[model samples]
Target: MTTQPDHGQELIPRPERTPEAVRVALARVAPHRISDMERHKEQALTAAIADGKIGHLRHWLTYWQAQVEIERRPDLSARYRAALTAVHGTSSNDDPAFRSAMNELAAVEAEAQRAVSA
Candidate 1:
């Protein structure tokens, strides 16, 4: 049991031991608690690819890496990696365009990481 001051009048404090109340509070906070890097990494990559902003093969690779690293979602990561494989072709991972795209995506992902850290 606890007491709280209400403008100098004493009032009974609410108990903090309710499991249902705690769950509700956590649910309300979960979205803000999720790291921005984890939430936005895939959205950014999906937007870049859909908008033709990715200029090289490397963009796809770096995007895939971020999906693996930041997202850490195996199902979604596998799809992104498969798309990358389709775009750059397994035999031509050495392609320059692919490399450029991957590098550009890496830069974008690095910025996102900094943002999330901040």
Candidate 2:
């Protein structure tokens, strides 16, 4: 079963960087994305096997490990999306909203990094 952090907790210990771990975490926190994740995994595996290189699979695992950190945290996920929206919605970097959004995005990314590294 997928595990979630207790209320008020901001991080969960980094998950094992494996497809099975990613799949289980996705199932727990982002069930709707499981199909897409599986599809990406299939493509990564196929490309890795065809190329006789493991880089493709490694990239997939690394990318998803960070993603699961955010997906598993509802507050962070909302902040991430809002920051993206603010960044996209503003045309000028000088805009206060844009600056604020950039700061928020950086914070969210930092938190995600810490969660993954923890």
Each prediction's TM-score versus the true structure: 0.27, 0.67
Which segments of candidate 2 are over 4 A away from where they belong?
Answer: 1-7, 10-14, 88-107
Report the C-alpha lDDT of model 1 over 9-102, residue by residue, as the tens digit: 2122222323333223323333342354344445666777788775433343343333323233233334445556654653565877567656
For model 2 the local lDDT of residue 9 reads: 53
Against the true structure, candidate 1 has what lDDT?
Answer: 0.41
Model 2, 1-118: lDDT tens digits are 2344563554444457678877788777778988888888899999999999999998788768778888867788889999999999998999999999999999988877766655
Clashes of each: 11, 0
Q: Give me candidate 1's TM-score against the actual structure.
A: 0.27
- lDDT for 10 in candidate 2 is 43
Cα deviation at 60, candidate 1, in Å, is: 22
lDDT of each: 0.41, 0.79
Q: Give the Cα-based TM-score of candidate 2 against the true structure.
A: 0.67
